[model samples]
Structures are given as structure tokens and as C-alpha cells.
Target: MNAPAPIRLLIADDHPVVRDGLSGMFAADPAFEVVGEAADGAEAVRLAGSLEPDVVLMDLRMPGMDGVAAITELARTGSPARVLVLTTYDSDSYVLPAIAAGATGYLLKDAPRDELLRAVRAAANHEAVLAPSVAARLMDRVRPPAPALLTPREHEVLTWVAAGATNREAAARLLISEATVKTHLLNIYAKLGANDRASAVAAAFTRGILTPGTGA
Candidate 1:
């Protein structure tokens, strides 16, 4: 039986040191072959077309075309190379776009050598690979935010406010100090992300925290 051929790789980054380091790292391993290096997204796109590597280790913040654009172009042109995003940023601002742009995997620059190698291998095999942090960030980006929590007192205060009661009246009705009513209103404003009583009432109604024709 013959051994499988090495996975061809293209390293694309704006930093010379990163490219050099990656090249050296992969060169040390027999499982991978570093075919070419590109300093920017445009060059990456160009080199990817010519090299026809199995995988492209892309950096997101490169000048000119950027990694996302390169990934987009590669996909648009139907390049067979898989894109493995290797960058320092794991924020939603960075991770979401690259994935949306057609990255096969996302690994942070700080990933361990073994993990990165495995990720590259996975990418070469057309498997999805995501750093733990990147995966978490992606999940958070896709998952809906938790609904706002409101205390019973805050709900009551909002209900009274929504019923068109003045603060003094609400205080008298709730048998609480006007100052206490004001405090609850502030908390409601913050929880509901409302600028004022009217907006707070509106937000409460919108969120189903308050029902129409209901009062405290």
C-alpha cells in the first residue's frame, strides 16, 4: 500500500513573520507541504488559483483585499481549496464574517501547534474545524439573547405606569413612598432599555411583560 500524499497548503498573512513561522512549522511536518505564501488577500487569491493547494491558512486582517474577501473570491471562483482562518481575533465582529464568507474552519493564532495541525488536516479533508473560543463566539452570535428579567415590584410599577397613573398616584395606589416608586421606575427603565416611563410601558407591552387593559 502507498502512503497518502502530503496535504498542500498556502499561507496567507499580512505579517512576514507569521507567514515565515507557518511555513517553517509546516515544512517540519511530512504530512503537509507549504506550496506558497501570500502577503495579502489579492495575492492569496492569485496564489490559490495558481498553486491549487488543498487548504489555505488565511489571516483575516490583511490589507487591501482582506481574508474574508479572499475567501469570498475563492468560493465565488469555485476554487477547490478549503479556507482555514488563522487569526488572533475571535470576536463576533471577526469570526462571523469570515465564516459567512466561506471559511472551512476558524482557529485563533494562539492555538497550540498540535491543534492547528489537526485543524489544517481537517480543513484539507473538507471538515469543519473551529477553535473552542471561536465556536463559542459563533454560537453566541447565532443564539438569541436572553430575555430581560424584571422583578415583581418592577412589573407592578410598570403596570401602574402603563395604566397612565402619575408617580404620586402610583405611589399612593401601591402604598409605597413616591421615592420608592421612582426607584422601581428607574430599575424598570434599565431592564426594559427604555428612556422614559412611556417607552418603558411600550417596551413592557411589546415584551408581553404587561398586557393591555391590565393595571396594578
Candidate 2:
């Protein structure tokens, strides 16, 4: 059988050392071909257009046109090259915007060489890959807004119930009638796909609508 083509790579980083190191690493591997190198996002975009690399190792912070902007431009132009973010920042500020700008993968600079290589390959295959920290950050922010699933009053009712309050007690605290409390509880159960109050609370906890130590 014919051998598969190497994964063409464009290394983009403001640091010369980082660019050289990554280029050398990929060059030494038969599976990857280092097609070009860039010291900033603008250069990276330029080289990407010309070289048409399979993957671009993009750094989040650069002097001109940060990685996020470059990714946005590449996406706007519909470049075929997939961007795999390799940066030192795992904070939500950096991770969210890069992914939003069409990055195929996000990996920290401290990632093991093997992991980085795997991430690049995944990006080239059009698969989504995120570093553990980045994934956690995304998970924290990606939860459906509680208000979307439950109204303010419904949330208050559920919170009281989760705190072990009876319908009458919740109603008294909220200045509503017991009947209204029961109505809210039924709505909560249906929305949460739970059969009873306990399951509703459990579902709320699982969905991050309720925290462990929170109470009425």
C-alpha cells in the first residue's frame, strides 16, 4: 500500500526558540512535515495561505494580530488549515476566545510532547481536542443558564425544597400559597425530568443549578 502523506505543519509563535524547537521536533518525525514558521499571527496567516499546511500550531499571544484574530481571519477566509492552539495560558480568557475563533484543538505549552503531537494529528483530522484544564474551564461556563431551564420563582421554590423545606414552609417564606408552591414543584419536576422532589434536587445538583452547601 502507498504510504500516507505527512501532516504538513506551520509553527507560529513569537518566540524564536519555541518555533525552532517545535520545527525540529516535527521535522525529525516522518509523520509530520514542517512547511513554514512564523513569529506572529499575521505571518502565520500569510504562510498558511501560501503553504496550505494541514495544521497550524498557534500561540495565543503575539505582537501583531493575536492568535484569536488570526484564527478569526482564517475562518472568515475559509482556510482549509486547521488551527491547534499551543499556548501557556489555560485561563478562560484565552481558551474561550481561541475556540470561538475556530481553533480545532487547544493545548497548553506544558503539554507532553506526545500529547502535543496527538493534538496536532487530531486537529488535522478535524477533531476537537482540548487540554484537561481548558476542558474543565469550558465545562464550567457551558452549563445551560439556570434561568433558561427554571424561572426565578421556580428556582427559589426548588432551592427551598432542596433545603428540606415543606411546601407550606416554602410558601410561607416566599409569601405565596401552598398551592402555588406545589404548582412550582410540579413544573420543576417536569423540567428536570424527575418524578419527585428528591430527584429534582439531585438533578439540580448534577446540572450545577444547586451547589453542595447551598441552602434556603
Candidate 3:
């Protein structure tokens, strides 16, 4: 049986030291072959087109045209090389846009050598890879925001409404004026984003602001 061909790579970073370090690391490993290097996004794009590497290890903040633009250009021009963003930035501002621009993976510069190697392998196979913090940030971005909290008084009014109590009945039971009950209900409606008594009760239950058998 024959061994698999080494995964070809292009390192793209503005800093010469970073490029040299990455090149040396990959060169030391038989699984990867460092084919070329670029100092900026535009050069990265040009080198990517010429080198025909299996993966491009990209840095986000280069001198011109940045990593996102390089990735975008590669995808736009239908390049077969997958991009693995190797950067120090894990913020949403950096991670989201890079992924959106067609990066195969996002790994922080602080990642361990084994982790980065695994990420590059994964990227070569066109799989998604993200640093732990970057994955958490992405999850937070995609997950829906929690519903606004309701005040205790609003909760009480909603509880009563859920229990099928009329505003007048609820007010009499609570020893408050009917108008006061109405005001509370109005506030409850606004808080729960409901238009009327029935909707308010339903919304409250759905949002866990009110539970069955709860009282005002």
C-alpha cells in the first residue's frame, strides 16, 4: 500500500517571524508540505491561485486586504484550497466575518501545536473547526436572546390572569382598585409583549413568567 500525499499548505501572515515559524513547524511534520508564503491578503490570493495548496493558514490582520478579503476572493473565484484562519483574535467581530467569508476553520494563535495540526487536517478535508472560545462566541451569536424579565407586580397580575380571574375580581381579591388592576395589566401586557388578557396569560406561561396553579 502507498502512503497518502502530504497536505500542501500556504502560510499567509504579514509578519516574517510568524510565517517562518509556521513554515518550520509544518516542514518538520511529514504530513504537511509548506508550498508558499504571502505577506498580505492580496499576495495570499495570488499565491493561493498559483501554489494550488490543499490549505491556506491565514492571519486576519495583515497590511492590506486582510484575511477575510482573501478568503472571500478565493471563494468568489472558485479556488479549491480551503482556508484555515490562524489569528490571535477570537472576538465575534473577527470570528463571524471570517467564517462568513468561507474560512474552513478558525483557530487562535495561542492554540497548541497538536490542536493546530488537527485543525489544518480538518480544514484540508473541508470540515469546520473552531477554537473553544470562538465556538462559544458563535453559539452566543446564533442562540436567541432570553426574554425580558417581568417585575414581581407584573408577575402577580399575569398569574391572576392565567388563573382565569377577571381584572375586577383580581383587584377585589387583592384589595386594590379596578383601575389599579387595569394599570398593572397594561404594564404586564407591555412586558410580556401581549395585546390582551388571554394573550398575556399565554405569553406568560410560554415564557415561564407564570406557571400553572400560581396565584396573584
Candidate 4:
């Protein structure tokens, strides 16, 4: 029997040390083949188009076009590569936008070697992966019932949010247009003091408005 093909990877970050380190790590993994590297987000987008790696490990705070911006372009440009974000900050401010822009996973740079490898493999396969704590934190945002600001309809929307519904999915569930869903979300943000989807959910949690339940 022969070994299976390694997952192709592209590492993009501003730090040379981090890029080199990641390349070495991937090389050590028999299942990963690091095919390209980029020193900035703009270069990352460029290399992604050229190398067409299976997964791109992108740094968030790059000099140009940042990770979220680059991921958005990747999605818009119809790139086949999957994005897995690596950032120093685990805050919702960055994570939520990255997800919206089409990153399939998120991880902090301090993540363990095993987990990082696993995340890359999962991203290559189009699966969402995150630190367990990050996932739990995101879940908190999806269903926070805070400040009693949501009307029944807003609450309905929030429930879909809690269920991880994108605006399109939420709109479909509510039998409304996607534009209307965006309108409702804007209002929800105003009422909830939320600047983004993650913050809105977090506000709900802080206000004791949403609680997760295990099916009994």
C-alpha cells in the first residue's frame, strides 16, 4: 500500500518567522505539502490565484487587504481554495467578519501543533474548524437574549441566528427577501448595541436573552 496524497497548503503572513515556522511544520506532516508562501494579504490573494492550494492559512492583520478583505475577494473571484484564518486576537470583531467573508475556520497563532494540522486538513475538505473555546464563544453570540430589545419578529430572527443562519438562510426561513433580512439585522444591531453578528449574539447573552439548551 502507498501513502495518500498530501493536502496542498499556502501559508500567508507578514512575519517571516511565522511563515517559515508554518512551512516547516506542514512539511513535517506527511499529509501536508506547503506549496506556496506570501508576505502580505495582497500577495496572499495573488498567490492563491496562482498556486491554487487546497488550503490557505492566512494572517488577519496583514499590511494590505487584511484577511477578511482578501477572503471576500477570494469568494467573489470564485477561488477554489479554502481559507483558514490565524490571528493573535480571538475577539468577535475579527472572527465574525472573517466568517462572513468566507473563511471556513479560525485559530489563534498559539494553537497546538496537532490542532493546527487538523484544522488545515479540515479546511482542505471544506469543513469549519475552530478552537473549542472559540466555537463556544461564537455559540454565545448566536443566541444572546440581551436588553429585552428584540421584538417577537426580531426574536424570530435571532433564533435563526442562534441556529447559525446567514442572512440568506434566515430570510428563507422567515419567507422574506434577503434585503429585508439585512434591514431587520440593521435594526437588531441598533437595538442590541451590536456592531456585527457576533456582537449582537454576545449582547443577547450578556443580557440573559439567549440560552443554549440540550435536547432532552
Best by lDDT: 2
Error of 1 at 23 (Å): 0.6
Q: Encode model 4's per-residue lDDT on 1-216: one tens digit a residue.
A: 988888999999999999999999889878999999998888988999999899999999988778888999999999999999988988889888998899999999899998899899899888999877679779999976555567777777877887788989988889999998888889989988889988988787787667775111
**Which candidate would rank higher by TM-score, 3 or 4?**
3
> Can you tell me which runs of candidate 1 are displaced by over 4 Å?
151-216
Candidate 2 global TM-score: 0.68
Which sections of candidate 3 miss by over 4 Å?
Answer: 152-216
Task: Give the alpha-carbon lDDT of every model.
Answer: 0.92, 0.93, 0.91, 0.87
Give the TM-score of each candidate: 0.72, 0.68, 0.71, 0.66
| Per-residue lDDT of model 2, residues 1-216, tens digit only | 988999999999999999999999989899999999999889999999999999999998999799999999999989999999999999878988999999999999999999988998899999999999989889889776444789889999999998999999999999999999999999999999999999999999999889999898
> Comparing candidate 1 with candidate 4, which one achieves the higher TM-score?
1
Model 3, 14-92: lDDT tens digits are 9999999999999999999999999999999999999999999999999879999999999999999999999999988
Residue pairs in collision within model 1: none
TM-score rank, highest first? 1, 3, 2, 4
Error of 1 at 61 (Å): 1.0
lDDT-best of 1 and 4:
1
Give the per-residue lDDT digits (tens) of candidate 1, residues 72-120.
Answer: 9999999999999999998888989999999999999999999999999
- The C-alpha stretches of model 4 lying farther than 4 A from their native spots are 144-216
RMSD of each: 8.7, 5.6, 8.9, 15.3
